[model samples]
Target chain A: GAGVSQSPSNKVTEKGKDVELRCDPISGHTALYWYRQSLGQGLEFLIYFQGNSAPDKSGLPSDRFSAERTGGSVSTLTIQRTQQEDSAVYLCASSWGRPGSPLHFGNGTRLTVT
Target chain B: GESVGLHLPTLSVQEGDNSIINCAYSNSASDYFIWYKQESGKGPQFIIDIRSNMDKRQGQRVTVLLNKTVKHLSLQIAATQPGDSAVYFCAENSGSNYKLTFGKGTLLTVNP
Candidate 1:
């Protein structure tokens, strides 16, 4: 892909339901990241994947939030038993390298938990 | 739980005027900072970045100033336009992993 691509542009789900958001990073990029932004808020880092190594899960808010990157190419963020507070825009980004390289972002999936 | 935070929630500027958004981060270890512009319903777009070693960096119509002494960062936009109206965010890279810690964004509106 020319840029980061996220699936299911918008999702409205009931509280307690589970939801999955997918992200396909730009081709040849080695680093991928996930972030969440609530209404009128800043981006909250969630997770980061670098190659096949273990992900940096430091930013996941709680046990209900989890993510996995398969084959070092695509990634999925899963939220279990979603709550109303879970409503937010989920964004994904990718960079060709690390630290010094700038990231390219996806349009993001807006998840609404009612 | 500490992170960067914005000093202003919103700023209104006349078209063609200059705009400045400020951020304060808590971590002294943070080595990298980036500024981003996000429009409605869209993801954030990178504006410019500055490392801890440098006090300033410039990009097209944009400048990032980092004041490590005060743990503050600011983004200055030159010749603001209505199309430049959006939320601006500042993010810090605090660790070797380079995960970002973002501040509450500042909404900039260029009134024409």
Candidate 2:
């Protein structure tokens, strides 16, 4: 793809339901990241993957939130038993895994839990 | 627990005037900084970036200034236009970690 691509631009799920968001990073980019932006809030780091190294999951908010990058390209974020507080925009970005590389962000998936 | 913060939550400037947005970070280890502009219903777009080795960087009509002494970063927009009205965020990276810590953001409104 020309840029980071995300699926389901918007989602509305009931509380306690599970939701899955997907991201397809640019070709050849080995670094991918996930972030969450609450209404009127800053971007919160969730996780990151660099090449084949172990993913840095230190930023994941809770046990209910998890993500995985397959084949070093596409990634998916899964939220189990979602809560109303989880309503926010989930953003995905990718980089070349090189020094001074800038992150290219996707439009994001706006999730609304009712 | 290092964090990035902004001095002002909102800034209103007249069109054609210069606008300045400020950000402060707690981590001295951070070596790279970037400014992003986000419009309503859209994702943040990179504006400009500066490395710790330099105090300033310029791009198009925007300039980013880094003051390592005070752990402060600022973005200045020349001749602010209506299209420039958006929320600005500053992100800092520690080079080694490759993770970016973003500030809350400052809403810049350009009044015509």
Candidate 3:
């Protein structure tokens, strides 16, 4: 694909339900990132992947939030027991992670936990 | 509790006028800075980036200036247009790492 792609542009789920968001990064991009944006808020880093290495999960807001990148390409963010506060736009970005490489972003998945 | 913040929440400008959005970062170890523009219901798009080694960088109609001395970064848009209305965010990368810390963002409304 020419750009990073995310699945299910919008998702409406009841509170306490589990939601899975998928992201397909640009081909040949070795680094992928997950971020969350609350209403009128900035992008909050959630996780980062470098090839097949263990992801940097320090940014996950809670234990309920987890993500995995497979084959250094596609990635999934799983939010368990989603709370109302979990409602937000989940964005995915990919970059080469080389010197001076900028991140390319996907349209994002808007999750509404009612 | 470290984060980047913007000095202004919203900026309104007339078409063709120049616009400036300012940001302040708390992390002194941040070495790389990037500016992004996001439209309604869309993801952020990279605008310009500047490394700690340099104080300024220019791209298209946007110029990003970094003042590491005061931990301040600013994006200046020349001849702003109605199409330029969007939210702008500044992100900082930790020294020698690409982990980005983003600012709250400033809404730029260019009135035609």
* C-alpha lDDT score of every prediction, in listed order: 0.89, 0.92, 0.91
Ranking of predictions according to DockQ: 2, 3, 1
Position B18, candidate 1: lDDT: 96
lDDT of 3 by residue, A1-114 (tens): 489999989999999999999999999999999999999999998888998664478889999998888898999999999999999999999999764578889999999999
Candidate 1 chain A weakest ten by summed lDDT: A50-59
Residue B25's C-alpha lDDT in candidate 1? 91
In model 1, the runs with Cα more than 4 Å from the true position are none
Instruction: For residues A1-114, write the lDDT of model 2, one tens digit per residue.
Output: 388899889999999999999999989999999999999999999999886454589989899998888788899999999999999999999888865677888899999999
Question: What TM-score do all the candidates reach, one by one?
Answer: 0.93, 0.96, 0.95
- Give per-residue CA lDDT, model 1, range A1-114, as digits (tens): 387899999999999999999999998888899999999888888888897454688889999998888888999999999999999999999886577667789999999999
Which candidate ranks first by lDDT, i.e. highest? Answer: 2
> When superposed on Cα atoms, how far off is each prediction in RMSD?
1.7, 1.3, 1.4
In model 3, the clashing pairs are none
Model 2: which docking level applies?
A: medium
RMSD of 3: 1.4
**Real interface contacts reproduced by model 1, as a fraction:** 0.64
- Against the native complex, each candidate's DockQ, computed on alpha carbons, is 0.63, 0.70, 0.65
| lDDT by residue for model 1 (B1-112), tens | 5589999999999999999999999889888889989999999998898889999998999999999999999999999999999999898885474677788899999999
Model 2: how far residue B75 lies from native, Å: 0.4
How many residue pairs clash (N, CA or C atoms closer than 3 angstroms) in each of the candidate models, in the order given? 0, 0, 0
